[model samples]
Target: MRAVNSHNTPGLAGLRFAFGTLTVLPVRVSRWDRDCAGAGMRWAPLAGLAVGLCAGAAGGLLLLLGAGPLLAAVASAAVPAVLTRGLHLDGLADTADGLGSGRPAEDALRIMKQSDIGPFGVLALVFVLLAQVAALYELYGRGWGYGATAAAVAGAAARLALTLAARSGVPAARPEGLGAMVAATVPARQALGIALLVTAGFAAWGTLFGGYGAPRLALAVLAGAAAAELLLRHCVRRFGGVTGDVFGGVAETAATAALIALAVGFR
Candidate 1:
């Protein structure tokens, strides 16, 4: 990989890096500089959008084939895991284990860095996955359009958290690894601006096509973003900064929260 500086302008290379790193897509990234990494994080939401579309299609097909919502929801939930090789789930589990340890920062970070999954990790995965499936099932029952839109919105919003995590002020938890590579790559003001733009677009989408539940769906997206921010703040305080695992945790948590909010509010 070629190393690029933060001053380098990101273009197709950044998008390719985002898709290649974040999903099971077959794109190749040639650049691996701070600028490229920041660009990758900035475009991560597009990768999530692709993942959501795939997941939505799977669920919609299952439903079209007369499968019950439960099975369809499970399939929908599984699609992103398969596409991303369960990377986000692993991060969520590690983050849970680390936080649950209640030890000092160094000790907690050590536990999180370990490959083994602890009891807290296992339980967190179980509950979070179950919640995802349940919420998706309920959303599917509403209609294919609602279910698909919810899935896609949740995915994109979840990834938007990554951009926030990579903002200029956010420090890396360690001097090495992914955190170091992408840390402080994005300006905080730029991240916030992008977030607002995305939020406005989502709101417009909801209002134009969502009918009665438009406001609710928009609120769900905001709620998901809020959840991600909370998780990011917690990780920053607990581990001294963000890590790769922290980013993953934020994605999963935000996605789950968005789906749940949609499930409850879309009716």
Candidate 2:
């Protein structure tokens, strides 16, 4: 399977081809046939949507069963990790370690690529996961509706944040890696689709939950997106562009931010 390059061809086949490369989804397509690769990045939000729904459904079921909020929170938090094979969580940890040390972006990227986890990475992961679980538990204990809304929002918004980050000027941290594939393959249309998916998902969630009356939820998503953008810009300026790790970091950070908002009062 040849990697899909933006040059030469762009089509649905190309799109499927590229997406197939990243995921183990059993899609049927010709081998590396040159064609216009449609916007594969746009599908990221869709993937998030599926993951979010699965998580939310699990949570909603738990709630309906009168299960404690703790079970719902655990299910919500674990679903994404299972769906994406823990890609974003790993990215979050790597990025935190790289960026937390106050090293240059290049050095930071290097640290991120290293296999072993450092203090910063481990700490960041623990705190972020803890925040997610605690926030969901708190929100659900008050109202499953609120927790459900946050879960749906988080499922899409995090990926949207990452898409935005990929479009930022940040270059791939490594010569050829997941980051390079994302940076190289992502297009404006794909980014726009991601945005639309996020908006639609959030709006649907709000409608279902009688509006995220909690202003904090909206603020959290926005803040997360903005933070991801700023971080991407900074990384791009410092290192010429973002990598797969950076993009994943953006998603994880956005999810964490949204959860935090859910935990705090938004009224």
The residue ranges of model 2 lying beyond 4 angstroms of the native Cα positions read: 1-38, 187-197, 211-220, 265-267
What lDDT would candidate 1 get against the real structure?
Answer: 0.86
Top TM-score prediction, candidate number: 1
**What are the Cα lDDT values of the candidates?**
0.86, 0.69
Error of 2 at 164 (Å): 0.8
Candidate 1 structure quality by residue, lDDT tens digits, 1-267: 988654335777788888988998888787888888988988888898899889999999999999988888898899999999999999999999999999999999999999999999999899999999999989888888778888888778778878888999889999988878988898999888878876777777787564656677668778888998899999999999988888889989989998988888787
Model 2 worst lDDT window (10 residues): 29-38
Tell me the alpha-carbon RMSD of every candidate: 3.2, 4.8
TM-scores for all predictions: 0.94, 0.80
